[model samples]
Target: MSLRKQLNDILPTLLPNNPAEAIKGTELIRLARINLTGNYSDASLRYHFSIMSCDPTSAIAKVEKGQGYYRRSEPLPALSGAQELLAWTQGRLDDISGDDSSVDSAMLRIRKFRAVVTRYYEVNGRFPFAFRDPFTNTSPLGNLWKYPELVLVDWETGGSPDEEMSLDGGMLSLKQRLGIAPFRLHSARLRLSPSLMTYREDFFQTLSVSMWAQGGELIYAGPIADEALADGLRKLSAAYGVGVTSFGMTPEVLDDLPRPANILNAHPKETEAIMAKLDIHKIAAAQSRPHLDWVALNSLRSESEEADKLVAWLNHCIDERRAEPFKDE
Candidate 1:
């Protein structure tokens, strides 16, 4: 069967409302242009179809349609069109939702959707109607980031910081020195958490690993000038059982850290005075170590029946963590 027919049949089961109608309309338009006129480009067809998946009556949807025209008119307009469409979608969603709490939830969904579309454009040099499972003919929020290993990090803090140390200065400095773009840096209080008060260094190590698993890099930024704190960070890195790199508290080395430009435009920096004492390292090494390998534990659960129940329990905790609202500091 033609892909359009398959989609037409499947979409009703999945959407069954205005969204379905929009998708069907998009498919019909695409098929007619292709089968009869043979003038429609795949990129143009997919772009229109994806936009139609949004509410056709929405102002953002209108902008999306305009973007399609722009994309068809020229080669370089695809990225601009996609970017504008995303911004409009986000703005429209915010305007309608009018709920502060749902902002992160909504952004998360949009980012995931953006990531997929951006990747497709990057590879194919055009927008695509590539509706993968969760995003199929539905809003991006239908499925957000999910990893079954996030729950291992304890969220409760024993108390507030004795003195709030703003790491913005250090983070900006690190970004300048490293020449990396801005990325989310977890606040010191959030990073140190139950570990500092509990005096359980292992907890701090676990927290580092958890963040690494969720994001990719672990950055601890704080007053490393203190020798004791510096030593503690080294120990944390060692305990983390990952590849470790330490700049100590020396401003010279810290300032000398390699600056790599990236699209994220921000690097994760550990910046809590109390929590900043740990050596930061790439967490990729953990995958080889079974005890600390959350991914391996989860993926291999079926193969290793003996650990299936334990893995399932661990995954359940991770799911609970994943469901929690995103905390951006």
Candidate 2:
């Protein structure tokens, strides 16, 4: 077999998924030698590593800040194909002009945008719960109308979500007596770009999914540069109370970012550096409701395992009277 093909088959198994755990070139070459067809010089293998890491199709990836390589995550197959991608892009309403070659590239961009948003919210004190099953390959397109990509939880006491913090006794009691939720939940729909034509669908989808929550937020990867788009979004938000915010990460910027795992697990300094690239704009603020829609939530929990997990996580935290980041056991 050709060396490139051999590396492709072997690298994914040997490499770590996270950049922090990336293996050095020399070590990786030694590991690859075990499965390689013929004796290859270290220099040749290193050169191949350097070249293949640049290819998005290749399984190997170099660390953004250091000297090592890791596995590049495969694109999710849920919404593959250029036609499906352009349907969601923020360029134009009728702009499904791209060819079929952009499926993997577009899917990777979507994954990166999601990771950045998740990390952004996590660091900013809101615990984010992602809805995955609804976007799986086997799921229906109508799921977009019913499920949000993310739901953000903001605790009332302003405690560290990284560790368990005691809920305030008096404040908790007061809210309980007043028949109000101790925390505010906001459902969010995430998109790669913002377009003048498709902003309403985005707004309403956010509103629709958040019907059971306190509020809804429509978050975009790119900035809201077009005034008309911003105006339209603001008007919708005013009428419906859905929040809109832009992270200012264009497709090019998202492409330049590290893998999802690296971004989520970056050091404090690295995280700050990654965050520095964002030019966040809150186009319209969300209106919060006092309590959750139990009827809607009860119905949703029956449809989505993620919903049940979300509720279980929240219940566990409340039962313990402590706030901590959600973790799957």
Candidate 3:
């Protein structure tokens, strides 16, 4: 008799019930393991099988199988694509200072990693178990893949009205196409004028600064009061009862500081007076201090009244930890 026929007949005796279905399932798994192209060793196959079986007890077994696969595939050459990707990611993590350029590059690298993995999946029809941290041998996909790209665009000078509108629409469409939920970080710029100072209070009160600090980009307009900005943020955190180590402006704080207060400057004398009151050196120092949490915002500003209302509602939702419509006046 053929091997399949013999297995179908004999598996019934070995397994208790529904031997026919079990046999078919096993055959399908076997086919999947052998037919798929990208790097499925025997150990990987066994791991895949355990996962497919859906037995709770098989978790440990799968880990053991994974470990075996790693052992067998050890000593990946220094120049391999996987090794290079890991090295780049590690380097970024190690040397990432509070510089905007550095942060931007790191984010780009993350996106590149995602693109690589996604391409592999598309071509191979499965995720490679071997694609993991070289040191921990653990997959970062679970922790990082789901996190949306936190892009910070300056609202002013980012684009023309038509271009900005197109980009806003594009972002929404991209999220839908990728099956990712809408961005958690609202893309609203926080203006620092006296009139908007009240909004800052509402911001601190309405959103979980801790949660936002954990992820997302914070873009801001140029000419910010770096030191005052940091102090204000720190005070807000304290007022809200959130324990934060530090809060400060980005490296661009110096470049973006309100043009130095001078008679020749174009800014109005009153505006320059306000700018002169800001201690640039002190702000820079506060921002440069170690152990301080850096807060950034995207530079993109929403001009629409509707967008402003959405941001307000989003703030409310963030505070409540639910996305329900805003009911409170």
Candidate 4:
């Protein structure tokens, strides 16, 4: 059986009837981990979201706070593919931080570890690994199927012991370096429930500050080139009670600020020069010609719209979790 099939089969059994909330929670962990590496290409991170989906549930979930760190009980079926993803992400992180030695060491260690266990499983029909007392190997597949287990599991099955190491001098560090505060990036998904509606304003406020601090701009929902979308953004801003202020961006400022396009669009070179010339003040001042063309984009972005949708999807997962039935303690 393929790994994806195995994952789908096993994961469902771990939850209480509803599988959607579990899936959402899993993706959240995956996203935060991958993004920490800073290896996502223009659209690499987007692929993670594209592959995500969930079902609705009417059961309400009992909230648990900081329930110890989650650890997968079984090895991922697409272990090889996952390794490649890690490599790609780590490579980008290495490049950004100017640390080749650490990257090389980490990759080599992972390769050696994988090779040792995979060989054992193929030759002996079971993993040759063992864990500390009171712990035993299990499949991450969650007993949803009767397939024979091939991999050993403990705390390590889910990720490396140093999964948090990726944060050192990486994306998370960047945020800390900027002293950027965290806030809720509100989503339409949360608006679906009265319980979550309270977070709406707080969410947007958080996102706005985070984006600005990260050298990102607030690009609300809009069409790539639709005038209607632009007008819609103006209305949405007022309706949502979000604020927009004018600013300046000389070529230097534009070059330094991280544009959402650079992270989402497949082709950014064409817009790089133009985007750098966009001065916020000029656009707000109703400047004509070249300046206006660039200014229009700064006020809104296609990527922001995409990010907002992803946030909404995540919010839905939260709602789904809250609605799930729980067992008595």
Clash count list over all predictions: 13, 0, 17, 10
C-alpha TM-scores of all predictions = 0.20, 0.69, 0.18, 0.15
User: Which of the predicted structures, 2 or 3, would earn the higher TM-score when compared with the native?
Assistant: 2
Q: What's the residue-level lDDT of 107 in candidate 1?
A: 34
Once superposed on the true structure, which residue ranges of model 3 sit more than 4 Å away at CA?
Answer: 1-158, 161-167, 179-208, 212-273, 280-329
Prediction 3 TM-score vs. true:
0.18
Top lDDT hit = 2
Per residue, candidate 3 scores C-alpha lDDT tens digits across 1-329 of 43333333332233322111232334544554443545545565454544423222221111111111110111111111122222222232333345657444433333333233222222322211212232222424222221122211111111454442122444445655875433332211121111112324323322322233222212222122222234554465444433222112222332333332221233455444433433222111111111112222121113223324434654443344333422324
What is candidate 2's lDDT per residue for 1-329, written digit by digit as tens?
89989998999899997556889999998999999999899999999998887565677877644578877665322221112232442232134344545655766777888878888888887899888777654456677778888889987653555443666656777887898878889998887766554567778878888999999998888765543457678889889999999998867898999987899789999889889999888999999987899899999999888899999998877777776787867
Cα distance off (Å), candidate 1, residue 2: 87
Give candidate 1 misplaced runs (Cα > 4 Å): 1-217, 243-329
* Candidate 4 C-alpha RMSD relative to the actual structure: 27.9
Best first by TM-score, ranked: 2, 1, 3, 4
lDDT of 2 at 135: 67
> Which 10-residue window of candidate 2 scores lowest in summed lDDT?
75-84
* Model 1 score (lDDT): 0.29
Best of the candidates, TM-score: 2
TM-score of 4: 0.15
Model 1, TM vs. native: 0.20
- Candidate 4 residue-wise lDDT, 1-329, digit = tens: 44334334433333342222333444534544442533434344333222322111111121222211121222111111112212221122222345766544443433333332233222332222211111112222221111111112111111334441122224333544665321122111001001111223322432332231211112211011112222333454454443322222222332343333332232446345533433222101111111112232233234234333333433342433221111112
